[model samples]
Target: MQPFHPIPVSVLTGFLGSGKTTLLNRILKDPELRDTAVIINEFGDVGIDHLLVEQSSDGVIELSDGCLCCTVRGELVDTLADLIDRLQTGRIKSLSRVVIETTGLADPAPVLHAIMAHPVLMQNFRLDGVITAVDAVNGESTLDHHEEAVKQVAVADRIVLTKTDLVDPASREFALFTARLMQLNPGAPQISSHDEDAIAAKLFDCGLYDPSTKTADVARWLRDEAYHHRHDHVHDVNRHDARIQAFTLTHDAPIDPQALEMFIDLLRSSQGEQLLRMKGIVAVADRPEQPLVIHGVQSVFHPQVRLPAWPDDDRRTRLVLITRDLDESYVSRLFHAFTGVPQVDTPDRQALEGNPLAIPGYKS
Candidate 1:
């Protein structure tokens, strides 16, 4: 069979403590997230969550050693550009889907701009969708105090209501307000983390790619099947915080094996603890003859499997991650490291495993 080349990337955004990480953790555990790639971007000078997520040696990104110094734009673009190069050049494993997590405090517009406008970055990557996180308990006050929080909610393709298990009855009004805010931007779907609210909604496949297109499909990364169910519940339900959020990211394409190995290695070293679960269907460049299916829990990755034939003729790749303490940027760096020049000198796999910057998980 011929090789497939094309990928779909997703952006996850939310306010501080909105359960963005938690929702991500839940996603990684899905049996269906095999052969996927995940990027988590947390705010502040240090990115500690990368150390906790479990990923394949070549499927994860962690540049800060322990934190993120990505406050500057150039650094951010350079990082994303590198990941793109790996994906486009066959240096890194061809990823079926790219999952990105943004810091709670991040102004998503700039990040979106990078995905849409940057020359090197734009050619290979696309804005799947903005997955925003809101705290069911404190989200109301957060919106009132943090303009960034409001903006996060304002532009979301899918909203994951985190900490639904802990929402107070008093926060009902604000929760409703958040729902109204989302109603204003109905293009995106909304789901919850921990609670089973989004099961019937279109929250499952929140990507930007059109299933009809081949290489140039633009789509949001995270797709939640519960999009419609959640909308119905919003009006009829009294409390919306009792459920947990989870979703999927799927695609068809061939990935580079070497780059994937490096990406997974980085995940073990930096973000195992924060990583909850991961799975994906990948298109390997070397094995363009066939596709690969990958799956894993924190540190424990399933061996890549060869499918009898492409799930579909399009042959896109799919990757889904459920996480905590991690975001899209944190994860993106792993993919970036494989494709670009390392900003800081990083230890090879041997040294990284022993270093404190690493998250200890299943090594092989």
Candidate 2:
């Protein structure tokens, strides 16, 4: 039997007329993306006429650049499972990666949950990252009116500013728009759609381990520094909606595993819908030598992975959370309670576990 190797899956999402398909069309032409399977919600929605080579009877289209394109027949999980079966049965000669292009108006959390929570898909595939495309012309308006658009930008690993050529780079409006995106997602690097160097190499492989170096790039992966720097720039409180926030929580001491579990359970159970995305590296008291990594979308979390050792000298536990309509104080208080940090009026873990409502701002 051959050893199983999980394929890296990247999700591409954006708002209506955000140029997701345009970016994808360009990405498919890259030679490095060969043997990649592009799963789109609908074939009619995506314009792939220039790249189409031949269509198979099984609904898979062979692209001119050696990539494969398939539309979802039903649930995304079914489409993903079918890809796995095709790989195992020799139907797909080789599959290096999978890129899922979500519908423009869709919230990407459900797609992330499908891969992160499913038992079978989890084993065969690993979530590479989320790449969100924001239209330079109407992005600000889209984010202003649509909550889904805000969530899309908040949870992105790589934000591609599409149709940038149409907007003036030095204009005040464009600057404000870019600044808004930075506030929403400080860690994700923003790349222009027309950037000559924006190829497959730069957009993908945003997981814990760098494919090129084959090493855990913890600092780059966590990017807690970005959140810390966001405080330096003072902006009008009403400039953007306060409901969506990106922040980082850090602790120097190792956390008790049970306490950590309880804190996470309470947060997810009470406010899952508000939690757009959560990723962290924790120093556990039981095994301080090995750090545990956690990634989640809403309430669905990938199984905890214990790294052999701390990737760097910074052994402190750092959690980056992108939340919507969730107060940072609420999360901070919960963390303090679980970690045994005393607050004037906040209840400790023992008391909070008895009644989770004890947290000052927590709402269920």
Candidate 3:
């Protein structure tokens, strides 16, 4: 049976001349990254970007002919569709993942908007993560002057500080300050691009927001083992927009499958947009032997898979949510209502069906 789950497609973004290509070159150079499909977009003509990216035939798509936002938006969709076609037809043996290297001057939002909103493409690809490369030497001023750079940092799942080795030893202090400048979204893991080993580790599977693995050094993800939510101007996003937010939900007992399904359907149908990311290991009613892995993107989901066995004895349902305009009040209330627990003080579903937050769309 074919799975409803689609492979993750991570976006590689950074402002113009911010080492997005250099890091991509490093990734291509890495032997471990062989199972990669790199899609490079060149807004202007001539395709010099394609010349820089050296990969095997059929694996690399040189999209230098048109602007991804306008002229080639259809081609962008068709290009990914074509990759899927080749993969299924055995033209390409196997595809582990896809990476889109946007033009340095491009805004990732429209590109991401294309990926999420397009009906045919959305089913075939899942947004894996956004990796933003920032030039440590010039990042501060660039971030100061460029709103795109700031938005890049604001939405990144991981921020890589590249080209830091050349700076003077005292420059390390500025680097650290720049690193602090990025706590705007404290949930993302920050790493140095100079270390290939560490970058490899952070790029793929890090709890990022909330690592499902208990083995995750929670201390690092929390920035402190005894982490308490601290408000920062980096995270403030004006007196109005709330970008950095965190909330945890705890369940004392196992959840019934029917109840859990209903709960998920409610979330997918209601608050999908605000669900920037969510993951949990839940205890099932009869199967205390194994826990269900609950993972989702916006509204779409991978059939919550069940592990053969719990990673450890620590089997409590703990979920973490990272969002832009959402909070615990909204999520917890809806979940509590679906489950029979009256944790929320609000009225029943019939009353709140008309609410805006109750029907967030999965599409961008």
Candidate 4:
């Protein structure tokens, strides 16, 4: 179903003790979200944000902060269905946007899939973007041990580094943590949670929408240039935990659509579990001006979005892949084979004895 006046929904996720709730409280106070409604896991924890608004008998609490807050009583679907119903009826007033705060331990992939895959929800709600909160103190350890924590960072469009106040500003620890985040996910823009004034502006308008023009913000949404030439060299700091690795592949020539599909299929089939996230803006050979935007989480992929025109001068097929326990050479070989391009090997890389793209054992 085509979205007719579809509402934008942003997912707020983070690891436990990452200060997700703290950031959410700050966002709730923003006047920009006056027309927005928030759905959180628990009411008691978030209720304090709206100290001025009296709690109603029903689950919904009208915040003097200008947004409505509700607890997820049961499944997420039920909560969303109820919101839609209220919007359709006269129960809710001026509801334009929605935000769902996932539990700290939650893996955000399923939450994104739920919003994008449901037929009813798709018609009324579209995924705006995902904002993940990363704790400055425990982020590295969390990402090192928990795959769930890695997924949260991998799939985010925007990352908010929280608890920076606890650490010294001049400390190398914060700087090091930022570097790890960049390595894990280079496409996302990181904002300091303490920068409260900039939070609403940076986090909102993150999706494909340009509120000023009411058109797709493809360039801003896909910031492909950020990944250009990044990850060219492996760093000891980022390589500490080899379990999760991120790499960007660029092609100057346009690609065949069929080949692109095949490459994704092969990768998913072989390393679907390890493939944490794949995001790209491909330039098609047939249509140079129009580009295909692709995003996937694990085995599930959101439908490809084709923009009306090229967002900028750079017209290369740039793809950023984040995987867990997956070899970079294996992924490089698959992409180059499908695109019909030559793969370059570095001097330090373990040369694949037989195959040019990868080692002999990589071919499955």
Candidates ranked by lDDT:
2, 4, 3, 1
Local accuracy by lDDT, each model: 0.52, 0.86, 0.60, 0.76
**In candidate 4, where is summed lDDT lowest over 10 consecutive residues?**
348-357
**Model 3 Cα lDDT, one tens digit per residue, 33-116:** 555666765434223454343333433543222112112345678778877776787666566667788776665666666566
Question: Tens digit of lDDT per residue, candidate 2, span 271-354?
Answer: 999888999899999999898888889998888888878889999999999998898998987887788773435335566656
lDDT of 1 by residue, 207-255 (tens): 3333234222112332323322336234322222211122344333455
RMSD of each: 20.3, 2.4, 7.0, 4.5
* TM-score for each candidate, following the candidate numbering: 0.48, 0.93, 0.66, 0.84
Candidate with the larger lDDT of 1 and 3 = 3
Q: After superposition, how far is residue 335 of candidate 3 from its true place, in Å?
A: 3.3
Higher-scoring candidate on TM-score, 2 or 4 = 2
Q: Which stretches of candidate 1 lie over 4 Å from their true place?
A: 1-5, 42-74, 88-91, 168-175, 197-204, 207-364
Clashing pairs in 3: 270-358
RMSD of 4: 4.5
